[model samples]
Target: MSTPYRFPDYQVAGDADTTVFLLHGAYGSKDYFREEIQTLVRAGLRVVAWDAPGYGISPLPPEGLSIERLAETAACLIDREGSKTNIVLGHSMGGIITPAVYAARPDKVHGIVISATAGSFSQKSAQDQETFLAERVEPLRAGNTFRDTAGAVIDSMFAPTSRGPMVDLVREVALSTPADTFCAAITAITRYQGEPNMRNVKVPALLLAGEFDQVGRPQSMQSVQQQFMPHADFVCLPDAAHYAFAEQHALFNEQVLRFIRERVLAQA
Candidate 1:
């Protein structure tokens, strides 16, 4: 279990009927959702995004366990927030956690948004990822700096078309994460297995992937999407890579909010 994680910086939008819960990817802090939080708040929906244990301000887990524990931790936080219905969104590794939240407490989350992530980890790829995480430690210890380290990984996370402040912000935020914690998160993701459970999710879902994503590539996402609620909508952001949310913020935000309004909030 994770230590109690606080999201003191999350701004509540004063809206009475809707809440938006966002989870960032591995190597990301709560700050990853800064724009989404603000956008949802401004759109009159209460926003709640948190830094999971071992990332951002939250304490790291003792064993550096898998993303399953992180997903459970997030669901606990959502339960504590006192709303039984809200929109739950996750990106990348965070995307892997989204379904866990619903499975843990289906009553609390009315919808889900999974960006640039898949439910399964292929055996061969998982092994390769384990190797990469194990190997990156020396460079990280050699004063390789999160900024430079993050730069190396950025090419795999976003589309070539991604540019502007959001791109820079993603890099900075990725670098801000403690290197060990980042690696540990990756290790956990590699061993994770929860997508099969997503097949039972009853909430409305919006699945989006970038056309050129290299990390949580689009093809894997498509395979995962087929396991989602049959009624769930899936879309591809053109000219985008893995970080489609940052690559196309305006469009991403619009599609997300509109989906929530139509599928979750409107029914409520």
Candidate 2:
């Protein structure tokens, strides 16, 4: 049998009965969600944000990075941090992993919030997917570090109108990722087939999209919702791009809390 993956380093706050698990995107870490965590905590909800395997202080999994392995790790963490109600909130690449977590241990996940992502990376055309991987990996293979490429990549993730500390925060988080880990993540993401997992999700779901998001486009998310998760509530945050939670955090938090109260906790 293969060795077990290392449990990620995480932060937890609040004592509320409901728990929100914040899983960041490929370019993010637990540190990136600090502000959002505080907001959730203040709203009387417990929050747990983790550094995905190979990010932050978390040790890289012995098996390297794969969406399947990431889901397994996340499911284990959810079981460890059991709560009255557990809602898994994932952004971008993390969004792709959330449904797999639910599929792995549906019993552990009470609700799911998928932000700025689609049901599958396979949704992209073959050429586009290839281009996506080449653009990110070629630079690293050519000796450019994450710091050298993160700025332009992160810049593209925001709406043209977005500026200020949040933009800087995203750049800083992206820079923190080790080059090898980032490449592994990008590869895993490109190979991921999440639609089956997504279509199988029976639990309540909230799909949050950024209106101007070029990566996880609003139109694509809407199509995913209509095709796979018709029951899920879909909301597009105007003027926000890929990092809607940071770019228009107030709206993002409001919608999240509302979903929990109306869809998750209220139903309970």
Candidate 3:
């Protein structure tokens, strides 16, 4: 049986027929979308961004968090909100869970936006996964300060021309996240495989990429779009890094609003 968790909710903004739920990546929380939420509301979207269990003020999952559990938790949250239809936008690690959300509750999500993330981690070999955890995760559990990990993650993600405040916001959120949460999330992320779930997504999807994203390359994102969501529109923001929504806020907002307007809202 699938376990259900009542994770703490963070309302970013909006009050319209459609709810746009933003899911943040590892080292991030609801605050990660702080910049883009208002713009989305202005565009007539009912926006929702939450601190997933184990992040921010939210309590850790009772049974320890996993991607499947996180996805189901989001579905339950959406069900409780009672929106007839909703749009989900996920970044980085959140992207992995977003597809699972669609697969688990296709009835709830009208559309999805995948930003700076891939569909799966099963692409890597077991040795590579182990190496990833050792290099990225072990140190956290081994007592690397939150600031240490946060700085490394933030520095690698933002482009040279990225926003100062947005970068700072992410760094702040990353510093606040508990070390345990970071470790567990990375562990779960390394083992996840979303390719199968990607195949099951019935909703329209918009794949957004950053031209200078080192973590999730534009080409990889484009490949994901071609393979999983062939019909989905792929938009890449030049001069933007991993956090394109923050680096190029206006363009990102315009593109997302247009997609939700012309594609999702028009169809859903």
How close to the true structure is residue 26 of candidate 2, measured as C-alpha lDDT? 87
Cα displacement (angstroms), candidate 3, residue 35, comes to 1.8
Off by over 4 Å in 2: 1-4
Better of 1 and 2 by lDDT: 2
Clashing pairs in 3: none
Clashing pairs in 1: 54-59
lDDT of 3 by residue, 32-103 (tens): 678788788887778888889888788876566788888988888787673766988999888889999888
lDDT of 1 by residue, 1-268 (tens): 4343333233344565677887888767877677777777788788777777787767776677576667677777777774646888888877888888888778888999988876555522666456556455556767787667666766566776688887877878877888778778767876877756578788899888888876666666776676555677888888888777778888888889889888887777
Which prediction has the highest lDDT against the true structure? 2
Summarize candidate 2's per-residue lDDT along 14-101 as a digit string, tens digits.
9977899989988869888878888999999999899999999887765569898898888888889969899999999999999998
lDDT of 3 at 153: 59
Model 1 scores what on Cα lDDT?
0.74
lDDT of each: 0.74, 0.87, 0.80
- As for lDDT, the candidate ahead, 2 or 3, is 2
Q: Which candidate is the best by TM-score?
A: 2
